[model samples]
Target: MARASDVFTEGDADLKVLEVKSWLKSRGVRDFEPVSLFADQLTKDTVAAIEKLADTCTANKSSSAIKKAIVKGIPRQAVLKPSHAVYRLQNQRFALGDRVTMVQDSGGVPLSVKGVVIGLNTKSIDVVWDVPFMSGVTIGDRCSEYRGSTVEFDSCLNLTNPQFVASTNPKAPATSIPNTPFKPRSGPYPAVRPAPGHIGASGFRPAPARFVVSSLDLINSVL
Candidate 1:
């Protein structure tokens, strides 16, 4: 396996033998000899010193003061430009129903307005603000109805205390009918009469004809 000093040297070429000796001296490693004379002792001490430096660097990098220093060292051009149109197109994090706050100057004073995104186009976004800014206007009035309310997508900034608006499309109520138990037929008293010369259960039978004797006796009495 490669020694720790070898790994450290691979990262930083400025850490020379003299700097390593100085680091060891600061860490209370006395009686330092040349690596040619005491190779094993010098190598062990150098590794320990490099390890200590690495730990110190890590701790310093994590500190807020060192972090500020590192940030200040970075060029202004390296910072992300949120106002760029191309950057806004590439990283479109907002959508319809997302609440956004826009910072603008009104009457030479900075004003912050919170609104919901109602529409989106190629170059701009239409927002409907919840709070009414105009005079004689009631609360919950849409801001887009007023002039100069539309904001460019690049100029808009996401609010820190973001509250996502719910969808306007409501779910339709169910119209399904419930199933009912089957009911039997009721109130039936009629009996079916069979036709004449119809076959009975025993055998087939002929129907009887009516008598005509009363008409002849009545005619003889009248004569």
Candidate 2:
């Protein structure tokens, strides 16, 4: 907030008064006006004198800029900080997306009110917090060690513990020997042999094999 007298003293710094007023109008300075004392001082310098006067007026209007800025609230994202992080809770179990508290000063304190994990590595995890101001957090303030804690989420309600596996026999060979060739040999059947002849009361041949025939000489003599 350079005063009229203050601006005139720094002649090279402050340009002129009327020009300053116009600059203010362009910037939407509603009630801007040039101080008469400043205008009279710049009247002595006729070469670009009005421009100098405007610059002086513009310099004095810094207070107005401050006032306008005060009317606007702080930016939402500007306040909430986000950054990479490394943390471990009890037993050194590291996992991505594990929420954490950022410490007030990374070197001094270990935990802040709120933070969350967004990345993971073999031994380190990346975290992001709603508050950008918490970027000062360091490994010292955090818990390199903590209690044995487990996640209480409901998404894995039906999950079970690791189980032992047992392997089964593999598939048989694609080609194999025929079953008939491998079977043991048994003796031949007895049906091919004929049965002994049955005897009748007259000791003659049975009717199934009976036949009648005589020699030619016997037939001729009989005739």
Candidate 3:
């Protein structure tokens, strides 16, 4: 997952604070407070402003909008981080409501931590950690470290590989073609013969004699 700041600062383009506010408003985020900074601020300040706006969007469950703002605001071509949440979801092959066990410890999150995927973005995968955060220690909202690399877990259990099984619904019986012995035709199917004096199966017919003309006879007639 790309850091929110990294995502905002991609393409090496700069943005005015006012422009950032405008983008937030367009993303249905109207509650962010604009920083009273210079119209021409440093790259870091601009990224900070965008990250703050992203935090507000995350709070409002509009995390995906942050990337949209970045796309539209950046004048130069911006590349989505390879480890972005969308790609990570595909590579990891785990999904919302899946039961997963952490194989290795990450950050302060212990081994065997389990959680359900609640939200995901370019930043991180938001999970409702099975073990809740404690007092005097802030887990900072059960999110994985950048690109969800830290929080990914085994989707399957350790004991055995999964096996395919038939459905047990009696109402929907299993159906298959019968195994009766039969021989296929050795040649192409016989063409249907057209009725006597009728058009052939291809529906092709020569022009009538009255409409036919020979080039030499026509030239002689014209002469």
Ranking by lDDT: 1, 3, 2
User: How does candidate 2 score on lDDT?
Assistant: 0.33
Name the better of 1 and 2 by lDDT.
Answer: 1
lDDT of each residue in 46-156, candidate 1, tens digit only: 333433544455456644564333334443333334444234223334565556665444321125555555445445555555443453121122222232245565455
Clashes per candidate (backbone, < 3 Å): 0, 17, 1
| Candidate 1 lDDT score at position 141 | 28
Model 3: per-residue Cα lDDT over 26-111, one tens digit each? 99877543322321112333333433554554467655665643324332112223234222223243333444444443254444
Residue range 1-223, candidate 2, lDDT tens digits? 7666576665644456766877888998764333232111111122133324434555676654674334244433223232222111112232333445542233322344333333233333333333323223322222112211122111111112111111232342232212221111123323233456534334345567666566986788899
User: Residue 20: error of model 3 in Å?
Assistant: 21
Q: What is residue 52's positional error in candidate 3, in angstroms?
A: 29
Which residue ranges in model 2 land beyond 4 Å of their true spot?
Answer: 1-90, 103-105, 108-110, 134-223
List residue ranges in candidate 1 displaced over 4 A. Answer: 1-92, 106-110, 135-148, 160-223
lDDT of 1: 0.44
How many Å off is the CA of 213 in candidate 2? Answer: 78
Residue 197 in candidate 2, Cα distance off native in Å: 75
